[model samples]
Target: MFPFFFDPTMMLLIPALLLAMWAQMRVKSVFARYSNVGSRHGTTAASVARALLDRFGLRDVPVNRVSGNLTDHYDPRDRTLSLSDTVYGSSSIAAIGVAAHEVGHAIQDKLDYSPLRIRNAIVPVVGIGSSMAFPLFFIGILFRGQMLMDLGILLFLGVILFHVVTLPVEFDASSRALRVLADTGMLSSDEITGAGAVLRAASWTYVAATVMAFAQLIRLLFLRGMFGSRD
Candidate 1:
């Protein structure tokens, strides 16, 4: 009996793991470096977020402070934008960049961005599938049940799809943030370059996630093939 999670297939995960770690470190390093650099106009991220939302005629979306370093997000369901401790009141370039990226999501929601809508729509199912995939796969292996194993593999595919769709959503948001930051004169031309660096660094994290998801999916398929062939 081959030990699960310790097989040769785990080697497939190595590059993905390294990339994910590098992405996290790169973003943090970039965010920290730019955090020391203040905005040219000293505009707080929260205020910038509010101004952008208002400009988009999404005046009803409220910007709220949430606790944490880089936990900022836009919750479309609640029509709320939450900025983290590192961004909410900070007038730093990185903070504003992060703030604007989140507002980009809000605007995507307002405009009904198709990818964003698809991502949001499948979220509930993805949550269920992601949670059940492994357990069911393991159970199938234990009982030598092909149907159970196939079902588990299918569930994991949903997670991979989520990661794939997420890449475009994130890229589009960063793109919007940069363009708007320039158009609104929120960040100076040189400062926009700095913000772009911060946002570009942030985007790598999503790319890393997608890479990892694909690697894991491949690992699962390899394992399933091994087990199925044995059966």
Candidate 2:
């Protein structure tokens, strides 16, 4: 059996894994802290989202409550905004922040944001790539097939590219959310600070994910000894 812990590739991945773990913890901690603090206006998350969408001339976009924690999203395909149950009705700063962030995606879609359009166009390919990457790579290794291994690496790179694209999309959404919230008077300056903290913490998770994916890709290259030769 391969001793993964002692592997140099694995050793190099440790920092990225630790950073991802820390980012996850930070998002949860910050979100939880602000989730318990009610909004100054005592407005529910759904109301805030609806109001923002309307302000942006997106009255056609409907907000719906769905079950789950932090599962809020704006589905561009259906032109619907879905908020998790906790966020939909909660009159909390965290809830409002999350809701607004999702609305930012709707705005992005409405405006045809270039990164978002590219990201959406590649979703299916990324899904297929992610599903096939592991099996193809493992089989190629077992059979010592260089072509198959190269194809597997190519597919995995698509997955990595997806993560890379996601960074800008998420960051832009958070930026739009904070700015809109402030401009619309949905949150006071101090409250916007707390919301910004939550959004920033959430953004770190995407950064960590991208870093981890890149590290994993590098580890794979190292494991295959692809860096040693000019093919």
Candidate 3:
């Protein structure tokens, strides 16, 4: 019998859940609004991305078109930049902001940014920890095994650390994207404002995710009797 089926500890997740919802809605609204506003310079997203990458001395990084909206990313592992369907050919402010953000990651990788390097290094271990955390915790609860629960808490700790580290990486990337856009004259002052707004709105999603991860960890700890008393 699972005692936590009706556990009150789950109440701790409500604030983060609400924040996550609001962040999703806010980003989507902002992105859609700016996506309709085309760049005055009339440059394709891929061309802009390539130009930025080359300017940053990353000529070797290939920019590729990919399907799906907002699927854009820079893969440090392969040194490739992928632009999503919504951004690959568009000349909109939203598209350019997205392209530049991914490029920011490439720049980070090129410079060997410490946080990013640490994040990339932990990816493998975090994968294992995330996959096992919940299952191990539930098994521990079912058997009243203290060590198993403690191990679960520890494994989940890696996931929490990942979320925390991601916050600064993302914020720094946005800052780089905005600054580069302004410096290269890729976007005018007003256009830069628009792109900055899009990036700023999108950042809340990561904030929400980090908050949710922390809340989950707290809930796990409470269940383990590390803090609050269990009924």
Best by lDDT: 1
Flag regions of model 2 displaced more than 4 Å. 1-8, 226-231
Which digits, one per residue and each the tens of the lDDT, describe model 3 over residues 1-231? 336566888999999999999999999999999999999999988999999999999999999999997889888999999999999999999999999999999999999998899888889879989999989987887778777888888999999889888988899999999999999999999999999999999999999999999999989988888322333
Candidate 1: which pairs clash?
Answer: none
- Cα lDDT tens digits, model 2, 45-132, are 9999999999999999999989998888999889999999889999999999999999999999999998899899889989989899
Q: List TM-score per model, in order.
A: 0.98, 0.94, 0.96
Predictions in order: lDDT: 0.93, 0.90, 0.92
Model 3's lDDT to the true fold? 0.92
- The local distance difference test score of model 1 is 0.93
- Who wins the TM-score comparison? 1
Which residue pairs does candidate 3 place in steric collision?
none
* Model 3, residue 150: C-alpha shift (Å): 0.6
| TM-score result, candidate 1 | 0.98
Number of the candidate with higher lDDT, 1 or 2: 1
Among all windows of 10 consecutive residues in model 1, the one with the lowest summed lDDT is 1-10
Question: Under the 3 Å rule for N, CA and C atoms, how many clashes does model 3 have?
Answer: 0
Q: State the weakest 10-residue window (summed lDDT) of model 2.
A: 222-231
For residue 116, give model 1's deviation from the true position in Å.
0.4
The order of the candidates by lDDT, greatest first, is 1, 3, 2
